[model samples]
Target: MAEEPAAPTGARSPSTRGTRRRGSARHRSYLRPEQPSGSPATSRAARRSARAGRRRRYAMEALAAFAGLLALVAFVGWWSEPARQEPPQPGGLPAVVGRPSLPGPVPTALAVPGLRPRERPPSPSPSAGPPSPAPVAVPTTLTVSQADIPDTVHLTETGRRDWMHWGLGGAGGTVRKRDGTGELRDLGGRGDRSGWDGNQELFRWRDGAPVKSVEATAEGVYVCGTGNGFQLAVAADGQPRTATVYLGVWMARGRLDLRSSDGGPSRTVRLEERHTSRSAQVTIRFQAPEGTRLLLSWTVEETFTPHCGNVGLQAVALR
Candidate 1:
């Protein structure tokens, strides 16, 4: 090359340095990432604004879609609603409206094996009824009479209902019928009574109370003076019954009075023995209503002697 003019003292040597200029080059470092254009706080605010805008847009879109779905459901229901109908009147018969629903099946009773089937009886008519029961006839007859003393006086239980005997253990003691009906009662008397074993007629019994058994005995009780005697009663069951009272009089007139405790007919009989002891059996057959009593009262109507002439009682039997 034409001898290159001698390079100035400040120029590069030709072997290593080029006379033409080289293209410009630039280099970046991976160790440090590049930051955005603005300051750190400003860049973060811008990113947040962008994200919030996107989120709001998405939420609006979702809300709008939900509102549209509700509107669609309402519209569908309103348009497809069923029409109104009148209720079926109860008075309308099947011929007029046809049966709205089929009748329910009736229950049928089935016969059990080896068993008989019984049909219900028909109801009774109002116009007719079973014949009324015949009116019961009540026994209303009462009779009082005197009778002779038999040869043998059965003083025991004697297959009768009840019996009461006085003076069995002397006076001031009594014996009731054992296991009897408890229909006979001694109601006490108005006067003083005493024990006497002088009665001629014999008394015997095997069944009694307080005194279980007794042999032949002539013991009795007596009340002295006029208008003083003994009282007795037998319960009435609206049936006929008989009662025999063993009584006696010594030198006095004795009176036997009878009546129904509930108030009815009354009868009287008299026995007089002014000189000696006289005995008799009064048979009284009476009938009265239930809850009545056959009352017997023996009183000394008159006295033959001034010294304690009295009416005597031995025993009473019932049937």
Candidate 2:
């Protein structure tokens, strides 16, 4: 062979291979820990380091989760809050203000017809249930006697549906002057009744404070008191005339007596009771004096029950 191919340079003898392996092992030994299988202390230290690393990783993950939760909470809070409005002008207080606003344009003029004269409606027929009898305003005249005077009188200035008439006080009832000229003075100072003897209260009449011999005429009588009540006697000195009387009171259980005392024998012409809560009118035709003296006396002895002020006598007019 061409001088046997130069000895192969890459090939190693068995001895050389053994020596190189030994040197590699020696270098590895130098770099390794003192304990071939690792000392107990070193092994324990490595395990602790591994555990610390895992714990640190877990801690970082937890921190990240907490941060994420905080961010989510912040987002939800921001979304749930009401939308912010523009800041108010300085010194301007927030207040609720409402005003009427036209939906569109307003009209400048209105089309209305001029008012015309009106005509009255026709009256109902008689066959139609007594024809709602035309609202005939029949002015009434009332004649009052001394015996017909009420014991109490109360009135109101207001009106009510439950009452027949309302005027000034509680009942709003009043007694107008018969002559249409005169004022309501006192009860003439007629006090309470003295006793059960009716006559004792009959002739008893007082004015303001003194008992005068004169007699005053009134358009109506109003009363308020207790006991034997009050009395009045109006009789003419000569001719026979009809005495028309009207009595009204809020309370009930009152009595009235109209009698003739002149030209004719003294006789009971008309008698009535239950004059309260009603308006009473009586007409008695009898003989009377022309310039006769009429007596009106009142008294209060006891009360069955305390009562509020009420309408006594409303009015009295000579027919």
TM-score of each: 0.58, 0.27
- Local distance difference test, candidate 2: 0.39
**Candidate 1, overall lDDT?**
0.80
CA lDDT of every candidate: 0.80, 0.39
lDDT of 2 by residue, 1-319 (tens): 3676665899988999999999999999998866656779889999999999999999999999999899778656644655335445568966323322233376433422352322234544447455465543322222443344443321111111011111222332233332221212223334331111111111111221121221322223344554344455543434434434444443434444433332333333222223234444444444444444333333333233356222233332332
Report the lDDT of model 1 for residue 267: 88
Tens digit of per-residue lDDT, candidate 1, span 52-121: 9999999999999999899778656754555334465578833333223332376344444554533334
In terms of TM-score, how similar is model 2 to the real structure? 0.27
lDDT of candidate 2 at residue 122, scale 0 to 100: 51
Worst 10 residues of 2 by lDDT: 157-166
Model 2 clashes, total count: 36
Top TM-score model: 1
